[model samples]
Target: MISNLSELLAVAPEEIDVNEPFSRLGLDSAAAVGLIGDLEHLLGRSLSPTLAYDHPTISDLARHLGGEGK
Candidate 1:
């Protein structure tokens, strides 16, 4: 997920702080949609269009999607 975000943001993967709000990383709604599309493709499943808003941070989203435990 961090790799994907870094690619989208044109930043190094290490620069993506997991706890930071995606909006703080410059991910506006449109960008979030684009991100969701990428994630859907990668995950091989449909996801809520508002998923980004629903989980505003990388860690939050990852946890919600069962990527990481609490």
Candidate 2:
């Protein structure tokens, strides 16, 4: 998930801080869609852009993808 997030955000995997905003990572809706597409393949479920909005950082998204979403 972290690797996916890093790829989607166009940053080094090590550079993504859970404390930082996703916008700072330069991700927009287009990238979110692409990321969701990949996630769907891995998770065997669809993910909406709303999930990207709700789950901002990699850690948050990891939790969500892990099926423990808030």
Which RMSD values do the candidates have, in order? Answer: 2.1, 2.0
Best by TM-score: 1
Model 1 global lDDT (CA atoms, 0 to 1): 0.90
Candidate 2: regions farther than 4 A off:
none
Model 1 earns a TM-score of: 0.89
Task: List residue ranges in candidate 1 displaced over 4 A.
Answer: 67-70
Candidate 1 C-alpha lDDT tens digits along 16-37: 8999999999888988999999
Give one digit per residue, the lDDT tens place, for model 2 in 13-70. 8987876766677878888777778888887976785777788876778787777945
What number of clashing residue pairs does each candidate have, in the order they appear?
Answer: 0, 0
TM-score of each: 0.89, 0.74
Worst 10 residues of 2 by lDDT: 18-27
